[model samples]
Target chain A: MSRWGRRPQLSFPDVGSIEGPLLEVVDLHTSFRTGRGLVRAVDGVSFNLARGHTLGVVGESGSGKTVLSRSIMGLVPGTNVERSGTVRLSGHDITAMSLDELREVWGMQIALVFQDPMTALNPVVRIGRQITESLRLRAGLDRKAAYETSVALLKSVGIPAPEQRLRNYPHELSGGMRQRVMIAIALACGPKLLLADEPTTGLDVTVQAQILDLLAAQQRERHMGMILVTHDLGVVANRTDDIVVMYAGRVVEQAPTAELFARTRMPYTEALLRSIPRLAEASHTRLRAIPGRPPDLATELKGCRFAPRCPYAQDHCRKEEPPLRAAGQGHLFRCWYPVGSAEGDAALAYNVAARVPAALAFTGIPVRDAALVAPNAVGSA
Target chain B: MLRFIATRLVQLVVICFLISVFAFLLVHLLPGDPTLAILGPNDTPAARAVLLHQLGLNKGLVSQYGTWIMNIFHGNLGASFLTKQTVTNALGVAVPIDLELVVVSQVLALLVAIPMALIAALRPNRLFDRIATTSTFAMLSLPTFVAGPLLVLVFAVTLKWVPATGFDRLSQGLGQNLKSVILPSVALAIGSVTVYYRLLRADLIATLQEDFVTMARSKGLSTRYILMRHVMRPSSFSLLAGAGISIGTLFTGAFVVEVLFQLPGIGYQLVQAIYSRDYLVVQGMALVAAVAFVVVNFGVDFLLTILDPRVRRA
Candidate 1:
């Protein structure tokens, strides 16, 4: 191995020594003006990520999770795309930075791992060249130094016989191995932040665990802040320090991971949790699928965008938008009637009694009892 | 790679045999008797029979084919019916002119088309792309007959850049030969450039949309690096495939170009031979053309495999 962690001739932003959180995104909006209309892909998404902390942005398809990560890095491309926000990296405003300035930030200060490894790595280029490109060009390393650093990067990402692998093209490697190569390329510059947008997607179950574990190990070793963007809540449940649940281009709920899970207020968040398959359940148990598609982002939307699919959606939820309100310190959610809350249980009971399809679907759980337990826990604490 | 080459060689042989059979059949397929074409309307019953006997046409069809094939294998292309000149000698004069024209035109086409497509692809539908796209389409509609004369009128007649019409051998002087061939090469090359540019531009636009290109951009690679390193080769697949069939223009003599420019390439000879019913010359030229077409396509396939490793499985 060619000396891991030795970034000779390369500059790195000192982690944890910064005055503020590693990244601060305030009222970030990324929208595309398509033929249909203006599509607000990421609408007013805001969050702060501390150095060495892992924040999970959880959502289903088209939930704007991916766009949020890209917006923060200033990586969103397209002439028609418009981004309005304040994204500060290490106290410097990233969103206001020009493209030439952003180029220096990308891969050196903030790098991204794309979703599909099959298509992420350039198929024709050798694994070595793809990894060493940033080193030679951006880091000002010579050919031999870049070559050695590339092999070391491949080794750090856990590729075996990285020297031999350096000569192999992407097609020669398996999907898992290609992702590792992608990780190596992203990590080649040793950026302070790693935004992995669905990193383990499209891999086997066994390989998924390994890839996620490798990401965690690398994140901890480098003390880099990471934004794990995935649709699967279970993927981030134990791995992340904080979680943001997005719906229709907006974050509906967010909290520290354990606190969010224990006192999950949003019905959408509760529904997401129930949707994950549990091993304790009997084989062939029917999966709890979230009902209805997400609202069309092109059309102007008011109120809670998740109202139509939410089990405890009330009339007020249909009429007016719910502002982000805190359930506890650092725990924010948007809902008129939250899950495990007194109003949430009443709305659920009323809906089930009135034969509302969404609420009746989840009547298998004792909604009232859960709400009762939550209030007592809140009072005691 | 060796296996790919081996398979292509097998294919080339099979293709050549098919061409040979077609060439042999052409005399019978088109209403023609080599001796009748040669003797004119003079009283020639005995002479015709003597010529037929010498030609081995007195034998049955299968035997005639076998004899013809064997004669060709021995490097004997019989004398032209019209001129009484050996078919091999006529081809010896014509082939070099055609080879030069085809090679120069195709090289010129690729040299211009590659960069044109690349720049156009960078900003698709923008001013540069639209202008290039429109100009190529306009050129694509102009056949070689029209384009060849138009070029001569502009560059040769009006501008007095070079001789309007002539054929000079390279041994005379490379400069005179190039000057003689310039108009025809541009005329022939315009069509190829249009085709290659359109194909490569479309493919490059599509390739730029691929996920890997975005990944490259995310790596802080410059636009040029992402385009050249990640985009160009994958985008060239269709252009390479188009070049395979277009190579036919190389040997099919580009009749309009040769005749218009007064270059005695194989195409001009083939047309002249057809008019005079010089069946032996036609047969020889046809066989050479078919072989050239197949060989060029095999080379295209070989180049494609080198560009894209995914094709190595074939």
Candidate 2:
């Protein structure tokens, strides 16, 4: 009989010998077959999340952060997309599992909090039904029991008038309330790992913090692994135990969150930190926007994907790609000359002196303004 | 909700009145003299005038319209000039047959359309989808008259499973009545099935891509469960609206099918009355059909508001 036939036994078996990481992703690659060419949405990425730890995935749009999360969850949309990787959740290699087998993992072992609360819910369904759905499906709870549990879950998510809210539709609730309901539903089955992809993207600034805090508190309470994917560095700064910064479908840098901020090695990571709009800055300060567009995934590139926009790119940087290497204890980055190293500084000075127009053209700043920004950037590096 | 329904009901009344007036004028404004047709074209002018005055046709158009409207309020639909039978009684005998045909055809169309559309939507661009699409297209291209005869030839003549070109009332044995309607219903339903299949397939495809469907999958709901609960309901809203308008068309198509099959339906009665210049019967049937269309559309609106909270809030 399948696992869902009986009441779930909470006692986990000791699968001996292969006592691996709680969640292990090895060299995951997800590519899509577009009309023009193959677009590598996620290429050669890997990470581990121990139980009770939060892994923050930081990247801009099209950085494959969303696809990486989906790939891990086995939720990638179409057969046209090719994926090769091993996603071992508590020793089972889920990468090769069919969709039917994946059902046992989803909700019971893993759950996801989608990005848009507005569209992430069935508009016609009541909030109570949405929350109770997983409870009934995964836990085999009866309708009344599931509904009561849903009410409790709503209360746990800090929703007021939980009973009333349960009867209301998604559109009847405010954005914050709907997001809280989404969280409630994600937690309904007591998942071992929760993948929250930009859980606060479209919400108001004030509500974003509340939702993030709620997720963090729930994670701590349940002691579940979490992968928080976001484009904003500030969101994961204090929330995540570790951070992985991706660029052009590959991880550019990975390190402990504090270490990543304090002694960042990748130029892209350093540039990202510099671009954050600090509240301490003087009023009306111009935010330093990143230069150039993200690399076109449809095209093949010869070298480091960021070289064209990197201020420290040498000729060799354009000819050869740099592999991810350890720069410091528990720190890994893909860069020929690590940021803050003497070689990196010298390369930046050489590129500046060479008057490389292509490298500077991406900044959209005049030469004089770039010259002014260069010293401060180099000093930070 | 009550207020909305009340307002719609008022509008329904106005619509029915307008339809009555249009039907009355259309019969009256025909090039041939209705009075002459009734009295015989060879009759003397004095005789024609006497017949016209006796029949109240000598009254002005406004007075005639007023009298017709007042009689409608009193449940009188005037009298057929040919048989002198009350139009209401003629309709009473015919309306049930048309209603049964329309209802049965619609039900049959939905039964075939929804599942096929859903299957086509499930794995779009696949073999099942392609076959369903092609077949529906072929079905759509075949008009009712052609399909009706073809059904007769296959089921009535070849297989001899059902009687050819006739209808049995439900007051008869249920099985016999169903057997009689099977061919006609299937023939009448082909076009609707094609339309509904296409509309629902498109909508279901779009609905399946919605984030809610992904969310349902994330909850570990079975594919069948997700399709039935999450995808089907929302996708069906458009199908329901389309079905509402198609009800009107179905009635029109039923006229051809009923006449072809020699069924004693409103369509048959209306066609026969028109050929024989039975103006009262034509007017009554036209008004009834128009009223049904309006009422059905109103019901669709009410159902939509119930199904979609957005429409309700609006």
Candidate 3:
């Protein structure tokens, strides 16, 4: 505990080895059969989330990050969806649950907070009613009890004047307030798992930070395992316990948060890190973006999904599919030529060293604490 | 909301007064003298003139219009030129029959159309949706006269289930009257249903794309719940709006159905009045129909405002 300010005591049980993962997505492949052809939105993706931990699924649009979240939530559209493999949430096979059975678990055991809070809410209904609709239906709460609980929910999500706010419509509330309301609704029944699909995607930067902070705090308080799907790598760095880097519908790399950044084995993961605008670096410097758009999911690719985009793709990468191999302890990467091989590691290390001076020359720090604080700053940047 | 009603009321009054003026002038300007119909051709010209003078038609057009307008203001549409019965008394028979016909047909249309639309939208591009679309298109294409006869042949002549022609008041016996009215109501409703189904289908498809539906599914709401709660409620306004806008067409269809079925409704009476060259009866009946169209449409507008808050706020 810190000596200065009081920290909210979180008496969460210590992270353990015996509990087994709360959620395990084993090689899930979900494809939609459209008129044009079969588009594999999520192809052979796999991940695991232990209890009370956060797994950040990070990728650009069309990388199947959002689709992964939806697949887990069992909310993919279209009747002709060809879904194979298992999404075991709390040890239940979600793919086999009937609609009624799914409803029984929806808000009570698992819930989703969608990207756009404004459009995600029903415009015609009152906020209070929308919050209570699931609670009352799933939890069998009476009208009085549901309504009273709804107020408490609004307050829990950090909305001021909960009673008055409940009377307001979705449009009447600000964007930030609407997002808070959405979180409140999702958490009303205290679900064990929360799937936030780009939760702060559309908000202003300031609001996005606040929302992320709130979500982090809430997840810790409730001891809820969260799967945060986002394109912003910076968001995952500070919040998530584990990171899954996906490229073109497949999980290319998975590792602990710090290791994924400090020792990115996959070229896609390396490119993604290089693409982020570091505050410790120079201003007005355009980011090092990954060349070429994501591979078309409709077409059958024989080799690595990222081969066309990967700068280090060998002739073998074009012919063979790279299986996810152990890169380090608790770290895996699906790359024929991993970023830290003898050939790439020397260049990568040299690049990291060269980047330090360039970064220092770029951001002239406001030097109050001297140069001793620079490494901590580098970890953040 | 009060202001909106007040404004609508003011407009209604102005519209009603204009209707009165038009009805009065059109009758006065009509080709045949109403007295000739009232008094048979055997009556002497002098006697006919005296009857006309008594009815105030012998006066100058301006004075005559003023007097007719005054009578209209005092709740008199003038006595029936031929029957000498108060037009109001004649209307008591005409209005209720027509009201029942219109109401019944609308109910039938709504009942049939909403379900057809939902089915079509739920399974779009499938055989059922294709069939419904084709059926509604066929119904829309057929004229009411043709439909009326075809229905009569099938249900009345072939099946021998209902009478082919003629109407009896429900006071005679609810069952008998309903049997008599059913064919005509069905005939009239087919057209309305065709239009309503098309509108509702379009609305349902659009409503399905709304974010609330995605939200509903994400919350694990069943397809049925999502359809009813999210898709149906939001789209119900479009159906009502369509119904409101097409009231004039429905009334016209009602007229054709009434005449075809030999129902003694306002449309039938108006036809008889027009054929007999009974100017007062024709003018009064036409004016009443116009008033009904206006009132029904206004009420529909008000209902739309209530159902869709956006319209009220606008």
Candidate 4:
């Protein structure tokens, strides 16, 4: 009955009660039916995020972090994609919602800041029009009001001469500026949840930091739940409240950020943590790369996905897949011998003695340097 | 933008000049002589020589070309060898028909192609997409020559719905003019629609996969709205380029369709001029067609600059 005419109102059942988590995803599975085979992009991932809390989903490329974020947003590409499981926002089931129904949820309740801001914005559209479109459509703001809000949003995102920038196209902006515009568009409607899928992936380091700080600051000011998806652990190290480590389209580990780093359990997470190049380390240090490529999702696997690359891998690890099990308070890991356990230590020691070259190969480093770097790596773990 | 337009205008002029030279030389290179065609073979050598001298055929090729170029600048396209009528006067009568045919067909083709392409792209690999793809291929394979007769048989001969051949000027009743032009226009349009349908469909499929489209989808824009606004514009670049080149083919197609329908268009005149070896008419038509090609391409470049920010900024 408003300006758009006869749109179905998207009213939540209980708007007043805010007891449960703001977002809850349970047993999510998203697969693609490619010509080769069925590729399980996000194989059985589940996590919950509370209001105003930040959750970081970390993984290597092809580990399904992006897919997982998209799956939550119900934006999986292609009709061939097969998705199952519940995506609940504030106790309301959205997994079964039609696109028309989901339209109400998107932009108003949830929004996404995509990776590769270079290509994430429509090149032909003016920046102001792009930002104001959702405002007019979803928020039902008048043209003048939307324009004013768009200018304010751009200004809030730290763009200079917001009035003039509104007229410029995406190609006219720098990469970092484009990313800021993307953030501004995502934040325009003031959604309760913001999914940032590697928001700073292609920005320069200084710009990356600035963009991340801007996002964190905005999230805090708006008190919005955020899911920060990034392959770089350092981006989420101090920013997120909780972290989910994905491997081969599955959640290998999930823990509170401080707890995960202080007492790392999964060997894959430990390897990922070790792989980060620290500035405090002496210059000219060869980075310890995680050996072996991520497993092909099209092919079925019987054991833990990380077993092939784990130095602490045992015969039992090769025989059976490990279920996500609770290791400690607010921490879960998918490993038979969790790190720092007696069995894990004995396994590492035995592997080091029996197959020193194999142990060195696991870290993708020289044998002599492996021993020299092991102490410094384990001390951090 | 002004500088870009100026550069393009300069380039267009250069292209048209080269095309004029080529058309002039190619027409003159024909096996039979225009003078011989005009005068019977039994004509005396003295008479033929006098005619040749008068027509300036005895002059050097360069001198003849220089005179033709100078005449062109003075707005004289020369007189047809057979009819002895000014080529510009004939063109004045014929060019409008060809323009109407081309413009109507292109408009019809776009009206059909854009929607079909969009529907196919939106539900790719589905029944609609499969049907559209197969039909476009079928239409593409069905040459204008064949499609023209088939349409004539169905609409004019079999159904007796409209006239099968001939054209009415727009000075005539608007409705009758449209009715007369519709069959030939449709005949020419079928081939163009097939090309545009395929090009737009392919580009839309690829553009719909772009991250910005995903971003738009994530923004809760309706599928229809996204396809129309965000997906259509960016996906149109390749289609626009293809359409610009297709204008040349449209002319060729128009020649065949015009002859089939006996429409009094430039294409019909062109075919008649070629068969009778009317050198001046052929040269005039060729120059006009070449100019149309260059102008169409120039327009496309300007449109691309406006549509694409990357090109605009560059």
Candidate 5:
């Protein structure tokens, strides 16, 4: 044991998955029973992350990224939550563990760094007291030892005058320092899996870059699996090894960092990439804006969740919900007819043909010849 | 902190001045005249008018108020109309007895209330919590007057263990006086403790949900240690606020308890003064009560700032 006390060392289960990834989530479906009905926040979402790898979960607001992280930590509040599916960490099934069992694994096997460090830390308490509270409880450390360890934790996160800063309240620290303190707190027990929920959302762009670099360095040093949830594609594009694109509570696409950018099958993933303004590109061209808002969760969707927004959606896409089929060796997409390249006559024809059959099946809107119609209004004409 | 104190002091002065004016007007506007009440019904009209003038009733309302406030701003609190002695001197002797009673009652109430709250929180849906809830509800419904006689019947009339009425000061070698104060303090505290337990238990339960407490549990701290070191300290902030409000309202409740126990407090003196229609004494006692309220509120505010850093920063 360490100097503080005898803390049980967490054992990684041998599930004969050395050839595979360290963590695997299989068909995870989490729902909350509201007054209206079961709000399926996450439906059949799956991904895996190996040791020393960064998995970026990119989605719009209310797309279930935060809930997914909280589920992994077993920290979902409210009585209406109903979780299902297997979440295997080091080959152990963590989905069925009780809260007491989860407590033993928390901070030592898995830790969470939440968004908004200011709200996460208590305002009425000193930094030292808040940090040492866990140590004193779990490690059987007395006050003096806990205080010393707290100062050490502060220094590890690169805060200057760590000893004095421990005595200061959270309000006394800046946004960046507070986030660093959060990271320090998460890393206190040296966990293997670190789930960070938009860890640098409210900070300046420069500070955001610095914090991401810090987390990257820590993950590499500890050989830990990190899941970074963010909306900024630029932030994760260069940092993450793999990317899982979520749309309307389902995994729409999954690919390696380079492959996902080079070859995206799902129209939503392509739209997200196209929406980002490239400073290196020609300045005269306008930034592409994704048409329509996200799907309302209160409504029950019948087909593919992104079919209403996808430019290349076909009749089958509207009649049947598309599952994640293999687009390549590692790339996956939920669209029946996936589109990868930029806009062309063939791409336009493909989009028009896809919508015409679906519209015919639903509203009986006859398909018009593109050659006879007006050039500006292809779908309407 | 200094600015807060300065503002409170200004407020205290303004409140005391307004109270004096209201008390003076109330006494003067009543049907009975203080001179006749003190002099009896057979007194001559000429004698009453002469006495009224000497007491400064011939002056305008504004002039009388200004003089009363001026006397109060100095060391003087005016003279009692019936006793014809300095009000400060009379209060100097009576105030300590009231203080003794209030302190003892509040201490006893807190002692019982804290344990009840702890038991209630610890056993939440179990028998202990149910019993505490039932007993507190029963105590809350019972008024001090009813409880006083019931205690008298059980302890004094039936058991014959102690005297049922009156009080003796601590100066009498601390035996009979201390013993005499116990029954009254217990009777007063029973009602107050019921209210206190309800507040404290709610606070304790609320504190149990905080993130720091969750972190403490993850650290593998014992449940008792977490409750004592983390949960209790933060929860006390709310309890301190409730305690402050209770002390502020204590004087209002003190009137009923004092009358039941036959204690010589300012509340009793005010009641006797009102019955006799001694206008000057009533006005003097009202001003003192107003000042006491402002001082007590100010003290509670400071205590809150000391106990809670959020309040201090705010």
Candidate 6:
């Protein structure tokens, strides 16, 4: 309405006063109808992020972590894609909103930082336009205001020479700088929720830490809810308030970040943590890899999705599935023999005595008890 | 950028030289003689031999080419063996019609095809997409020979909207000139519209799947805005290249349309010269058309660099 009258002012209403979590996702399932069959990428995943809190969704490729974030934004749209379930932003049901209605919500109520900054920003457009689009359109800022706010947004994201950077295209900037511009664009409208899907996936280790720290700092400064999706457990270990571990399209375990790391229950989660190279480890320490590939989600899974590779998996785990059940305060896991518990310890010992290959390989007991078992204990392993 | 343009210009000069050589050889290698086409069957051998000597045709092929090319550098294209008219003078009368037809048809084709492509790409495989694609195929299948007469029959014979077959001078009112141009341009443009639409729509659909498009969508940009601002430029690479190729090879399409509608164009001149075996005129027309082809493609290449910054650096 400044100078040239148009549509009325439009932006995410400040819903900071609402009583519940900033965002809630209930039993979201996303599947693609491919030539082979229905590939369920995200299945029955549920989580919540309160105001100013960061929720990390950690999983490997094809585990539906990226799909989960897109689903929350209602970004998955196609004839071949079938998405169902509920996603609420500040108590408004996003899943039920029409695409047109969701358009109003996107970038205003919630914005997403993409996985790869290299391909996220438009190659032909200047960084100024990319960062200030939401400001001018949704926030109804004037041309001058949008430009000024964009410079500030860039500066807030730790970019130097903001004015010069604003005029540059995506290809002009380095990988880390492009990612910073992406973060600036995401935070431009002061969205109530930010979905960052592996924001540092293609960056080097040092740049990865810088981007992660930058996102965390912005999340704190704006007090916006965030869902950080990544495969590396170490990336989210210190940044997130809560963590959700997805395996084969389902949320296998989720808990408050510190609590979950302190008492890791799910074997998949434990294996993911072990894979991260630790500083205290001696040079050339062999990283522990979870022995098998993630199961193909197109097939019907009748038991625990992690059972085939679990070191302590028993008959119960092979035949029956476990729900996401709580063990302690705010800690949830899905396992027949939860990691570090008495039942899990007993199961591990029994497997070692019975000479289970996975159990032997996991515990490093093969070298110690090599004479106790036959030489060829593992086929694939 | 300067170096790139300079390189392309060099390539164009080499291409023009090759095309001239090719045109000259094409006429010279023919079984018939040019003087026979000029002096007629009743002319005596002495008259034809004198004409051949005067024209320098009795010289070796290399010397003949060298003399012809040297004259071209001196701004002479020789003369038609039949009409005794300079090729440049003939081309001056004909080049305008062909250039206007090509320009109008290209403009018309893009004007219609771009919007259609943009719309069809939005919901590909749906009802609107299906209709547009089906119509594109139908238009593509209809050759200029068929489409030209069909347009003439419908627009001229029945509706009397335009002349059935004829050329009009631009000195006549602009409206009168356009009236005659309508049928031939439409006939020439319809085929290219289909080709360009299909190419552009496919590229747009592919670009729409790119991650940056999704990022643009998540920014709350309208579908149309995203399609135009975020999607269209990158998607138009193939379309621009196709346009370049079409403009370069335009004589083939124009030939059919001009003959069908009786328009004065380079293609028509080439056809008539070939029928009479007027070798100098035929070679001159071919050389002119080839130069146009090379220049058009060169401009399009420059445009491609302008549209895609990555291309300039590369």
Deviation from native of the Cα of residue A5 in model 5, angstroms: 14
Structural similarity to truth (TM-score) of each candidate: 0.94, 0.94, 0.85, 0.95, 0.79, 0.93
Residue B86 in candidate 2, Cα distance off native in Å: 2.1
What are the per-residue Cα lDDT tens digits for candidate 2 across B1-314? 67777877898888888898898898887667777778887889999888888878889988988988798889999889988899999888777777778888999999999999989998899999999999999999999889999999998999999999777877888889889888888888999999999999999999989999988988878887788778888998989999999987555558888887888777788878888888878888888878888888999999988888776655
From the highest DockQ down, the ranking of the candidates is: 4, 2, 6, 1, 5, 3
DockQ score of each predicted structure, in the order shown: 0.50, 0.61, 0.28, 0.67, 0.30, 0.50
Q: Write the per-residue lDDT of candidate 4 for residues A328-364, one digit (tens) a residue.
A: 7889999987888888787777666555444666545
* True-structure RMSD, every candidate: 5.2, 3.4, 9.3, 3.6, 6.0, 3.3
Give the winner by lDDT: 4
lDDT of 3 at A56: 94
Model 5: per-residue Cα lDDT over B36-125, one tens digit each: 887789989999899889988888888987897788779687887778788787677667766777788889999999988987886675
Off by over 4 Å in 2: A1-20, A357-381
Of candidates 5 and 3, the better by TM-score: 3
Q: Compose the digit string of candidate 5's lDDT tens values, residues A1-381.
A: 434334444455533445667678988888899888888888888888997799999987888888877776666655688888888888778788765566667776777887788766766678887777666655457889988888888887788999888888888899999999888888876778898899999798889988999899889888889999987777889999999988877889899999988887777787787778888989876556665677876678888887766666655666788778886778887776666444323443655554533222222244344334433323311
Tens-digit lDDT track of model 3 for B1-314 = 78888889899989988887787677666687677777888889999989887877777887877877777779887777677777777688788778778778889999999988998888787898999999889999999899999999999889999999987888889999889889998888888899899889998988887767777766655576667766786688778877876664454447788888877678788778877877777777878887887888789879877765446555
Off by over 4 Å in 1: A1-16, A364-381
Candidate 6's residue-wise lDDT over B1-314, tens digit each? 89898988899899998999999999977888878888899999999999999988999999999999998899899888778899999999888888889888989999999999998888899998999999989999998899888998899999998999887888998999999888898888999999999999999999888889999888877776777778899999999999999987885458988888887689899989999998888888999998888899899999999888778777
Output the better candidate (3/6) by TM-score: 6
Query: Which candidate tops DockQ?
Result: 4
lDDT of each: 0.85, 0.85, 0.79, 0.87, 0.75, 0.87
Error of 3 at A364 (Å): 22
lDDT of 5: 0.75
Sorted into a CAPRI-style docking class, model 2 comes out as medium
The fnat of each candidate, in order, is 0.53, 0.62, 0.41, 0.73, 0.23, 0.58
The sequence of per-residue lDDT tens digits that candidate 6 reaches over residues A1-381 is: 332223233344569767898888998999999887999999998888899999999998889899888888889867898999898888888788776788778888899999899888888878898888778877889899999999998999999999999888889899999999999998888888899999999898899989998998888888988989999998898899999999999999999999989999998998888888889989998777777788988888888999888888887887889998997888889998889988888887777767776777788765456446763332221
Question: CA shift at B222, candidate 5, in angstroms?
Answer: 6.7
TM-score, ranked from best to worst: 4, 2, 1, 6, 3, 5
Query: What's model 6's lDDT at B10?
Result: 92
C-alpha RMSD of candidate 1: 5.2
The first chain of model 5 has a TM-score of 0.85
Total backbone clashes of candidate 1, pairs 3 or more residues apart or in separate chains: 0
